[model samples]
Target: MFLVLQLAIIVLSFIAHEHEAIAAYVPDYSSLVFPIHKHTDAAKPLYSVEIMTAYVNMQYLHANFLIDVDAPFIWHDCIVQWNIYPGSCPPDKLCTSPVSCDEYQCTDVRTSYSYQKPYCSPPKNESISPGWGYCSCSVNVVDPVTGSCGQAKLNYWDDFTVNVSNGKNVLTGVYGVYPYAACAPSSAFQSFPANVTGVMALSSSPYALPAHLLEPLENVIGLCLPSTLSTSGVLFYGNSPYYLLPQKDVDVRSYLSYTPLIKHPDSFGYFIDVNNIVIKKRSISIPANATTKISTLDPYAILRTDIYNRVIRRFSMVTKRIPPAKPVPPFGLCFSTQSGLRVPDIDFSLPEGKKWTMSAANSIKQVTKDVACLALVDGGATSEPAIVIGSFQMEDNFLVFDLENSTFGFSSSLLRKQTSCSNFNFTLVES
Candidate 1:
């Protein structure tokens, strides 16, 4: 039977500081660290943000925000406010008399809610009535993490101005915030903010806000994702070269490889050139002049079925073969666990001698105790024909997005051992 062999490539250059050594180093002050929350049932990581509410006393609301490379601006679920006394509160909460409150009902005239404390004012243009609001309002919506949506009344706030901080760095900007009732209900979760930006919008994103608002020289953003669930990772703003360097004093300038980032006007995703696919040191066949579709490096990996099949076919040829297991619902290929299969080492070669190597663990998925299948899924007819290098392929790697230079950099993750982000010594000073 064909077994998906798990290939483990031991590269000496990939290993770095031991946990004890890393703990001894002092944290850098210029970067903002956002911890990656790896959900048990989800494939992608969720980032957390502190949402400041303008109550009598400033209250901080924490929400799980998605670092979507595909979205242009910040989208969030906001609690509603009113023009009457005591200002605004969630829809389910009782409003003072004479406010004429009903489910999803506000005065016909659009108005901004001003609080007596004057901590933060609602956007002046927020429509008090229907057809005027930037986003729609919802109630009793089902939460994604917890099944109970609860009594959380959610409304939308466009151009919501808030001072977003990563503990050490503060970013003040107008986010395209919206209402999301189901953003982690057990906790007062509120929004999903996309951090990737183009040359024009770089200053608007939180990652580049320091450069735009505070320090002019600070412009780059770095993301280090741990390969395993046991360890946590960080997202940074400003200068964060420490995470990329293999050792404390060694400079990684000579080792770093960069590729141009292809920006799509209609989408916020990052696209790069993928020259060929190498399996077990063998290059797959492609027409010499055939146009190479620019592939996207997304948080989710979805490959064209044809491309996926071609890869699996090449993968099967060089390994011990076996009859495929009975068809699984979503997976095209599956092998019986009893087959004791092994997968080959796969590498995605970019244009400039840059290669992304994948171990068997990154390419295959275990469907059941007795069945394992290829993790690459068919992109389906509706999907783009281009390849999508998802987060699974990016595990254990440090990804740097330099908007100033317009290039993306990849290296082995500094925290390969899966150390928790909380262990880092850092400080978050208010702006």
Candidate 2:
């Protein structure tokens, strides 16, 4: 009656008739393997040179989200945890012999997973302080093996894989770089008020700079001294050469403004594959110039089979009315059949009296017809869920949507003509 749980589960591995690709629920984004490189300055009109040292060398990538499903012989029992920190432990004091202590002079340790040996080892000390923690995984299919709806759980099908690193380099640099000497020869380098906004390189190392960084105070470089400088970088005055009118304006441009740098891809460039990733059932195909394509039946080909670890997601909380052991997170993946999953183009951007309504049990589900299509032999479409649209924000029992890459498709004749589909299961109402 209230099920919206995707605590965590990813175990990807496809490679034989491969059909699984529609990711970006925010996992495997170590900035997509450290990618953000933009440094512009049509010759320093004001300044733009970002490279705060994010070259994707792993300050983080603890990985683990494996999905392997062929559904002919289901055998799931997932629960994995290893949010370790003892420096990830490996200093060899005999490896500190099973010494785990987090936040109690030990500093953090949590372990889970029982399908016989999923990986767990936390307890050590010698200075371990890194950051970020959330090792919560759960899976339980336990007996349901009857294959043949297109069975193939083992020739390969991976969904989860986690073990990335970089958790401790924290020091990043690059602060706007402004230096046309410091700006204001009336400032012009082509409408260059500065804030060129095309320079990035930040994965995670921000949180230190309260003053004293870039240290140049001799009155801030004498406030860019120019009260008639005689020489020391040219400044002649006389006929045949004189131009001052160019003060495009600057107060640090009101602290900075230049937007258009969505370049976070040192790895997941086309988008996704943090490692053994998973989210199945794809059939993609949407053209007429609206653009969208990705269907070649190679969604990792089930990752070379063996059910890898199982990951189905076409939506089937077991038709239950009481299913919540924990492990739900997926506000996105729904191909078609929960009554044809409706999106109706989703209008009402809001603003003007502000309005949006859809609750009486606001339900929609096309859980999976496996539509991950788009591959006219691979000319376009498959850029990885390039874009989808969604919006929500209702109250008195909440519903909110600020999404990015977008997803939501419903309409199997409007859920066979709604009763709200009699609770097919949807819970985003979060006031």
The numbered model that scores best in lDDT is 1
RMSD of 2: 28.4
Candidate 1 per-residue lDDT, tens place, 1-431, comes to 12323222233323434545665665334444455543343333333323332223354333344444543223233334434344364543322211122333322211211111123223222224553334323222222223233323333232222333333343342222222121113233322223311111122233222223334225566655444455455556555543332243432323356777765433434566667789988887533332222221244456666666787788767754755677574666677878676877677777778875666656766778888776676776445635777665565555666767767776533344343233332334434
> Which has the greatest TM-score?
1
Angstrom error at residue 128, model 2: 12
Which regions of candidate 1 are displaced past 4 Å?
1-28, 41-60, 80-87, 90-214, 226-231, 244-256, 285-300, 321-329, 337-341, 412-431
Listed per candidate, the RMSD to the true structure in angstroms reads: 17.8, 28.4
Model 2 misplaced stretches (Cα beyond 4 Å): 1-105, 109-118, 123-431
What TM-score quantifies how close candidate 2 is to the native fold? 0.15
How far in Å is the alpha carbon of 253 misplaced in model 1? 7.6
Estimate candidate 1's alpha-carbon lDDT, on a 0 to 1 scale.
0.45
